[model samples]
Target: MPALPSFATFYPLNHHHSQGACQCGSPILSQFHERMMADISRRQFIGGAAGVMAMFAGLRAPRVLSQQPSDHNRPILLKNLRLFDGSGGPLREGVAIRIEDGRIQALLANGADSGNAEVVDCGGRVVMPGLIDAHWHTTLAGISQFEAMTADPGYVHLVAAKEAERTLMRGVTSVRDVGGPSFALKRAIDQGIVNGPRVFPAGAMISQTSGHGDFRMRHEVPRSADSPLSEQEKQGVAVIADGEAEVLRRTREQLMLGASQIKLMAGGGVASTYDPLDSTQFTERELRAAVDAAEDWGTYVAVHVYTPRGIQRSLRAGVKSIEHGQLADKESVRMMAGEGAWWSLQPFLQDEDSNVYPDAERQESQRMVAEGTVRAYEMAQHFDVKTAWGTDILFSPRNTQNQLRHLAKLTRFYDSLTTLAMATGRNGELLAMSGLRSTYQGKLGIIEPDALADLLVVDGSPEQGLDFLNDPKANLRLIMKGGRVYKNTL
Candidate 1:
């Protein structure tokens, strides 16, 4: 029989598993087994393993592509199209857009100019800004909670990468990732290693002990001052920080890690076991500390809260965005409007996309949120608050397919035009609140002169209602991001 390989060959020493390095039972291990059977010396096998590890590391690192050079001097003109422009204005016809160097060079009349530019006849389709999701969770959206907690980080990231492509195919070209370890995914997407949205990443969700983001088990709690951070925190999913000083430190840490905005758990959540839905978390001072730290970095803080008191406390702390205020009363809505805060609301009406909770209490919490969702929308509109739309799909890869369906649900409350504008234009405005820390520099969410070239060619018009959006594969004929065409069936 062939000599069995050492255990070290199966589990490489010094491998950063937390950063998603390959492990035993992965394809790499199969290769290792094959090589060992080939009777290679242990030293040679170890050297090959090291090479494989180096290759995986390179995949994680950002690379500047010579093929995708920045200087795209040659322009691409998209002609013969109707435009939505993402401004919620009437659609314009008989216009062409000039794209170059990942930005819109100008808007021109049909057959206006020809300077050796490549021409793409859009066949009179409706060209509009790509959709933006204001409250996405990049790493957590596609996997179940059990998998997210138990699976290897590398495996989880692989799942996320696959889901990212699906998300882009849905015509959602940009997303504000509110939580989870999305730094690697963002980097991969930006470097062109993966095809996905332009991610505005908030590195991790910060929560007080037993608060919304606290994912620790009961046995792991009741700790000392210097307890090792929970597995979730170590993986950059969520960190439990108490008091003002710790809150400030954690906030700054995320900012240092390239957080475009900070996300603080300002209240209890239905998903968390220990926290009640009605409970408010984080003192005003603690919330303020995070806000101050984020503001110092020229960005802002968005809080996760639903209860009236929680919303009020977050508003008082200078939070710029409220992730979920479905349970907010009229007073809270009025306060949000007065403060000019962005209300990132979702359609959580116990629909097919709703997350399934195991217990009755959590189910009740979900029901309460669903009940308040309609009222919340009414209040936001009544108060003229700056409301944005997002599908907060979490822990269910199957439900991600309903992303466009979630957007379509908005039509129940508003007109088709208003729904499209909210998902595209208004959400873009909310993303701009990230300020200087924003990853993509050019203006997004509008098809205007000099805006970033993130657009889609839709086969239907808003007059047909947003029902066409429900089936993106058949409706979205072309998709472009950063002047690069990712999908073009036409």
Candidate 2:
């Protein structure tokens, strides 16, 4: 392998203008300069870079949340709760949780004294770790296929903001956005400028030419040095890169932009017009390039794949997560289990509203993948593979509204407890696979001391009735994320 170039050289920081001014042209450099001038801390600089990138991309700039950390530092105490600690088991009764500085300080026994914290009487309400979606697309939220293809960039960001708030209010505290431009949204939420889940962004989906990430219209020519990029690429949602070198460079770009993980299109997909559902996309070498780049940054590559051939190639290339393995065979599933890679599966219902593809062929491919959902789950379970649930709800605003309902669909394969765990604890584990590239520190998806304070208080025990998750707005009495109360209806 060739020596990898530094990120600064890969993405030049300075652009010399005709007037002889050496201006820091890129968003990354401008953010770095601003941080230096403002004397911002390292953590704030990292998050502010994302907000700067969003501003450069034509979206409204997000306010930096570092200056107001005190706003979220207030101590909180919940008394008399039935706790589901995100570990699979019966709920513990009459427990109390004490939160301070955005971390859980203690899990006290019933009737514990609250000290100076703001106490809320739970009245035996069920408290659990906030929900997590291992696979999500924050940039694509609340937009239909038609709108995504034609909507203005500003309008799309506005829609994404609204969707982020909705996702949080529904009890989901975190999401690993597998594809799309989510860096801005992630920064906004982290800074408290937006009410939303913690986001682990995969800046853009890297794809082989004509692969799943290729949202080019039929009339548009294939991407080349002289040709302009597609709108999606321009928006930082996805990029078309081929071969080892290009793939490596694109992966590095996303890593530089603060991607927790890299998403690669390793196979054909239903929504893309050019690729067949069963066809493998990227070559093994190309996949390896992506993995190598991600590993260099202490993260991993996750591939969008559905078929056995694609799965086998990605697994062999050291991909850490496999998305949409609906068409994966038993052998591929076993291989994934042997490697301990995650199967980020989505429960696709045939009766549900699907992405509106331009042509009949694309729609047919969508149905084919949807029909294979059951077989994929069965294979994963048979092999005891690590599984995570997500509502890969894309390009359909109506379907996006059913994010929790999609998690509920997991009950078809596993029991209610197991299903709930998949969405919370197991998904949290998957997000942590980003390793050092992860943004937020401390444990998530569990009600334990030293864990990040993302809790949801439900009116009833979701362990016994997972359906309570389906109607989170009604059943959720309180929602706290990172020690800040976003909703309290008790």
Candidate 3:
């Protein structure tokens, strides 16, 4: 076996992925090295290389979120675009984007040019930051929505890879997977084992039994209540505990399992049948335990809540964000705002010809499908919440594309421009990332110099109407992520 690079040369964080390589010398060590380089983000790369690369700014960036072009040095120019920077701002017409080192080098105005770069004429089409959905769930089961809630990690990760591509087609280049079985699936996506969104995944969802992710049926598990899931089942996918101390242990356990963030079910969910959406299960101690554990680990916790009581406890715990607040009242919204936690809403439960269900289940779900979403939207808008686009696009027994039309319609909550930000810039901020608007560095959500090179060019400007963006069949002229052209035919 070849001698692999030193650990300090590779990462500063000691992000040891023992499952694969990172061992001093193993067979196929080069394969592990290749994956280590490909799998790591600029941030992770810097962490491993902290001492060696500290003199270089990008290598030692404090936030590790700087948009300084570090990939390659030459400039690549794009011309003739109508640009939306995703700051709830107006679009710029006839603009040009300059990129280098896989970062936006600059965004020139309509006739603006730096004069020393290669250019591709966009033919007056719209250019925007690649879309990003902050609250997406990739580990789901069934050939359709009706099949069931699960499959194995390998099966689901493979399935998720396909969904990730579909999202890119819709102009979304990055996504934050809210929860999954473990870090394995997210590691697969991030390491380029599969091609899809730039995934920031929260491995395994933490839950108290009867909370949102508790899948245990009393009749099924005859083992002790304290038996942790088998090695076959991990904390990353579906972990359930009972009391506060137990939940607290699971919280720390997940961080050890390669999680960069934490996810807790504060209450019930529409999908999980046991707990009512309004019931708040976690005590203040449990909430504090999760929050403290996450704080100690250098990450944030995103709580899943659908009702007021659940929302209240989540606030007490100081979670960073809330997902699918289908029944939050105005006070809860205001409280969330005061607490500085953002909201991620999926006003996308509706679509034409996209229904799936057993006859009776479908009929019962219809009532929930309609009322819960409508209320969620109304509260988000009324409270002036930091609500952004988080279409929980589930593709299994159901087509993910069908639900998007509602997101388009929901754009009426804010102006069309702000709505686009929900899908791009605002969503980036919700992910707790920095530098999304045009002027900042380490950009993720816009097209400009020194920004990430994720872009979507379409025939019609989505700002013209939600329909232009929502139509799955809409004419997308090109899709690029990190300067790689994944799709080009219009």
Ranking by TM-score: 1, 2, 3
Model 1, which residues run further than 4 Å from truth? 1-73, 145-153
In TM-score terms, candidate 2 sits at 0.83
lDDT, candidate 2, 1-490, per-residue tens: 2332221211111111000010111122222323322432342355555433343354343432222223454588899888888887778886789999889999887778888787878887888899998877675556654564454434556677777888888889998887756776787677766678899988778988777766565567644588876544554656889889999989998998888999988877654446766779899999999998898888999988878999999999999999878888889999999999999887765555444445676557656776778788988899999999877665457766677888777778888878888877788888888888887988889889999999988886666667777677788888888887778777
Candidate that would win on lDDT? 1
Relative to the unseen true structure, what is the C-alpha lDDT of residue 229 in candidate 2, on a scale of 0 to 100?
Answer: 65
Report the poorest 10 consecutive residues by lDDT, candidate 3: 14-23
Better of 2 and 3 by lDDT: 2
Arrange candidates by lDDT, highest first: which order? 1, 2, 3
* lDDT per model vs. reference: 0.76, 0.73, 0.58
At residue 439, what lDDT does model 1 achieve?
A: 84
RMSD in Å for model 3: 11.1
Best by TM-score: 1
Residue-level lDDT tens digits of model 3 in 303-345: 8776788887888878878876767778888898788788877
